[model samples]
Target: MTSDLDTLFSDAFERANNTTKKFAPDVQLRLYAYYKQATKGDNFSYNNEDNLKNAFKFNAWIQLKGMDENEAKENYIKLVNSILK
Candidate 1:
């Protein structure tokens, strides 16, 4: 059975995905980082592409290295709720 945090995280992901409002770059990066950290944990890998956007994403996610998945999920849920406010 899925944990409560996992269910809440999935609901938050759905809300974030369905939102129509555009967010600032920093907010977007935070959402991206939190989502990645929650889902992929610390085992994520990215290609060394010269794309600045990819680099930024990698940096944001890397900063959350060693964060627990449940913690990341909680953070992501909080952010999504704040944004939807």
Candidate 2:
């Protein structure tokens, strides 16, 4: 069964994916990690492959310090959804 939330996510993903190419390094990093976290659970470990897949997350997070978490989450969701679609 599909939910409205799913559709919303799909739309957001489409937007983000199309927008990803223009994202700056910091934005890309956050989007990458945000996508990983959204698809995966929070407890997911940072194993080698996982870390390799997300070389930018750490840097993005660091750069985004002092930023609002909710904004970050929104942006991440959009960015991730974009990449997946």
Which candidate number has the best lDDT?
1
lDDT of 2 by residue, 1-85 (tens): 9655555555666677666357667566776655554444343444456555355565444455454544545666666655555
Off by over 4 Å in 2: 43-53, 58-85
Root-mean-square deviation of candidate 1: 0.9
Against the true structure, what is each candidate's TM-score?
A: 0.95, 0.50
* Colliding residue pairs in candidate 2: 13-81, 13-82, 17-82
Instruction: Write one digit per residue (lDDT tens) for candidate 1, span 1-85.
Output: 9999999999999988898999899999999999999999999798986699999999999999999989999999999999997
Clashing pairs in 1: none
CA lDDT of every candidate: 0.94, 0.56
